[model samples]
Target chain A: MKFSFPKKVMAAALCVAAFAGSAQAAEKVYRLKMAETWQSNFPIFGDTPRNMAAMAEKMSNGRLKITIDSANKHKAAFGVFDMVRSGQYDMGHSASYYWKGKVPNTLYFTTMPFGMTAPEQYAWFYHGGGQELMDKVYNKFNLMSFPGGNTGNQMGGWFQKEINSLEDLKGLKMRIPGFAGEVLAELGAKPTNIAPGELYTALERRTIDALEWVGPSLDLRMGFHQIAPYYYTGWHEPGTELQFLVNKRTWDRLPEDLQEILRVAMRTAAYDMYIQSYHASAENLEKMLTEYPNVQVKDFPADVIKAMQDANSKLLAEKAAADPLAKEILDSQAEYMKKARHWTDVSDKAYLNNFNAE
Target chain B: MKFSFPKKVMAAALCVAAFAGSAQAAEKVYRLKMAETWQSNFPIFGDTPRNMAAMAEKMSNGRLKITIDSANKHKAAFGVFDMVRSGQYDMGHSASYYWKGKVPNTLYFTTMPFGMTAPEQYAWFYHGGGQELMDKVYNKFNLMSFPGGNTGNQMGGWFQKEINSLEDLKGLKMRIPGFAGEVLAELGAKPTNIAPGELYTALERRTIDALEWVGPSLDLRMGFHQIAPYYYTGWHEPGTELQFLVNKRTWDRLPEDLQEILRVAMRTAAYDMYIQSYHASAENLEKMLTEYPNVQVKDFPADVIKAMQDANSKLLAEKAAADPLAKEILDSQAEYMKKARHWTDVSDKAYLNNFNAE
Candidate 1:
């Protein structure tokens, strides 16, 4: 279904012109509808789609309204992609990683376990032409996506027992998702994607051997530490990103003025969200240790990191062989990384090497 | 004048446990110098002070050390009542509202005439606020301060012109400062209290029929906008806050951690200073204009807003009837204003606001 933007011309040129012409307009109101991934009444921090809807409504002076529908209320969790593509909703906020089947190249956009770090990923997407490629992929499905937010360098899942080696991954039923799950599957682990509301219950029922969510802020909110004692860090998915997908038809219909306003508002929200996340993490980290002293926190073994890294490369090659689009994205990202690595080495790393120590 | 940080115990038990009882063994890098305000540079868009400096030196592996000088650079600007009360620093980023005295309250904070709009004031402060305020108010007694920052809020300056009654502000300079000289004193005017930088210039050029400075951000910044435009939005002070003076003695002895890290690294450089401000004003406003073009963007008319708000009687009576400290400050402010008005509001108004608005 072609997503129809009800405001103006559907073509891209109209959108660009609207932005330049925005400064000279009479007062008008806009309402933005959204279909969220996180179910209502389920308290999950940084629940991508929900936060997007919430922030947009507030900043837009109530003139731009966003009606959010959680995944559970819409259909199955994964149904979000098809619904949005069919123009069932104006936008869909969810993890790209979850819809890897629908959009194979989206894995890199989400989390690839041992994929790129957060700062590197944002830099690439915003400036290194990665966003252009992703937009190319979305154009086919009638979607325009912006990076909603990120869960900076997550912690590894909570486990029933200590992971001693690669052998331990074998046959473990873990609630993991998307591309990361495939890599774990290769290691003989069974991967599952459970909605956040159902996660704690699954763990309580002993249905899964392990689960990984985000950092301390969300973990503390979710109370994962209470049910699972073996808390592990070095999550393969560092800087996990979420997507804000606007139905191409609806996005196209917005007046150029409204379009630019929405974009800037989103960017502002994205930047502020990170700041809020940082403070939340600092405060929550201290809270976790105090409330759950019995919970054991451990860093992932270096060898485990090595194993994942090795598997990631193999998986990338296999995907590239099968899908040309995947290969194109991978190739571009790889080139960007080569250049970015050198610059950041001198910039961020060098600075940290000097200061973040004893 | 070693600006000493008042030692306060940590609130968190864990932090206390980590640092307590090990004072002697603490790492003591050579102390350095911090140049300005709290949460100035670091805690926001730019690198935070503690982290920026720590990262810089941390990468050097302790080979280099830096210090921050907060609240203690020279004599406080305007009247830093709290700086002395709290003993926060040998220097401080201050505003006229705080002191309003030692100089006339109005002259101390408000800017004058068609002078020093936001951008211009920023330039003048760095170049002008430096040479003049430092020499006359600060260095006159051997102290120093630099321009912290400025927010633009000037209206063609609220005026009695719109009221069709410039006579309302007759013979009243209304305590304008900075460059509001020519415009304020123009219609039927006189300009006074002008600092060496501003004083001689206003008198010679014959600008500033009347003026004011800073409002919401700081009462000082808003002063000019309200008086001339007759736009009495208290929001004048909504965003005019600035930093100020440090005592030489205390600033020299501070340790590296608090000095350079928090101060020099805390504030953004002058040229790149308006990064966020530019975003808020230009980007957001541009977008808003498209949606809300009718937002009232006009100045105040003369008589309607310039009438005797009974500024002096209130200023004098309150100070005279109050405590010894209040009396001292009020008298100082009044003395300065008394001399300033004869030539300004009384003499200047005859030519300026009285005949305005063709």
Candidate 2:
């Protein structure tokens, strides 16, 4: 009698433990839908979410599934913030600054015209309280944001002509966007917003004289090299970081294990995407040189860069003065950059310069 | 058929379905022992493994447990390769160059003097066949290696006197280890290895005139600043990437889910440590300047840097001539760095210079 009762109890216990955290949880697949800003088959930007989802599913052994809808599918390229925050999609892949009009503080998370570079910005986010500030901004909207991937330093933009002085910038019809666009506008450049689909045509037709998309990784595919002869090195959006947005409710609904899986997958995918972008950009830049020999890679002259920098600083000062939270965020970034930039100068910067001095 | 019979059949079927792939395997814990190169309280280096283990355990829901044995316990700072290979320790946290004496090709996997920077080297590793090359070197040893963490760019060294010319390096008594030490030796510097605990005493008592430790992050704690005031910028070990060694047998035994969990955990931890090092370096560098105001951060003069570069190139050429695999690795790195450095120059380097120009 004792054996019979114990066997029954043991059988019931085994069933419960089996279904608890591990393989048994696979019986109920937790599927999440994500919206991304880029169109389907978009190079580095679109690949990030897909790579993340695949990792999460494989690591979780099919316990977690993420399905993505690109801009083509969703028909809302800049609406990722609203979609994820409102739970229209469980997550989103977009740049943080896209929602700057709605959340003015959101502008600072992505790269600034003269802010810290990629590694420095990442260091600031993980260790120097950038994540805390980001949380402060997104928590109100019931959203969580993480660094999606870095484009290294973005190109300044492609120009039909060289930007030699401040006069070269005045009324210059460039299709830059976000804070960089604002800075350009302050410097008297006519910065306009155009759909990415229309960027190549617009640039060719002189609807926009130049446009800053991304670096060589995504830029080569846009056919900008064929049309724009002067490809300028970056000043605006240096080390631009795309973002991953998750609805807090969606994140909370997962088991602890799945949550960790999703988090780690996203983190690895983000880092992977950065490396991928670097690789693609390197390869593409080489191709652009050999194939389109006339596409010159030039730096913005000293006077032009200085003018943009001055305009950037002035606009930042105005923004800092307008809002207390903005001031806090800006001050923190400035202080962090001051320290990090010094390290960069001593380390990589000096080492890179060694080649030139040779 | 009896109703009870059908119920039993249904329950058995459900059990089989629940325990199929993921959860059933996670029910058993995989405990691994890791040997680390640093001591128990070592800051950045020791923290990498702990961070990695914590992430692995949490993400696997306590399924994968990694316990580390520090140098105090293992008493083998340089014996990690053997420990992990012999299965005495299931894994190791150490630099790959430490094993170069036994396996000459292991030298290229870590860092090189005047080599690519952190981001560039990372791009090389993930995208440009680095992992494959690393596998070729480590596979025969029954070990698997991954980039554990990056120390960013290393400081050249702390000197009692300025390295103003090539003549200054002649017969200089320096306690610098690994490949960089060899390069210095080629330039007529007497490169020696000293115990970590005795480094400060060695530098202070004039036993060693100069010593290259890590950058500000780890060096500040070692009290190198007080002993030597002339802190030079990095050229040697431009991006010193520490390594994670896993015994192949141990890796092969884990279930698919646990394997994925461990891999992702290691990858994330590696990236996290790089950011942590960057943050620490920035903070410590700031503190060092405030506390030791007299300390001068100098770059080795153009002539001195040129000599070192020449020495490095000569040694690399010799290594390449000695072994076909070494030749392959060197050529791959050179080619990748050529492309990646161009991107870096046009991106971060250009942007960083803009600030200086201003």
Give all candidate RMSDs, comma-separated: 28.9, 2.3
lDDT of 1: 0.49
Q: Evaluate candidate 2 and give its CAPRI docking class based on DockQ.
A: medium
Model 1 alpha-carbon miss at residue A321, Å: 1.8
Cα deviation at B311, candidate 2, in Å, is 1.3
How do the predictions measure up, each by TM-score? 0.48, 0.96
Q: Write the per-residue lDDT of candidate 2 for residues B101-197, one digit (tens) a residue.
A: 8999999888888888888888999999999999999999999999998889999889998888888889999999888888898888899998889
Per-residue lDDT over A139-198 for candidate 2, one digit per residue giving the tens place of the 0 to 100 score:
999999999988888888899988878888889999987788888898889989997889
C-alpha displacement of B136 in model 1, angstroms?
26
The Cα error of candidate 1 at residue A159, in Å, is: 1.6
The segments of candidate 2 whose C-alpha lies over 4 angstroms from its true place after superposition are A1-27, B1-23
What does DockQ give for each predicted structure? 0.01, 0.63
For residues A205-306, could you state the per-residue lDDT of candidate 1 as single tens digits?
Answer: 789999987767577877887888887764467566777788878877765534643564454344334434443454466577788888776654556656
| TM-score (chain B only), all candidates | 0.40, 0.95
Clashing pairs in 2: A22-B23, A23-B23
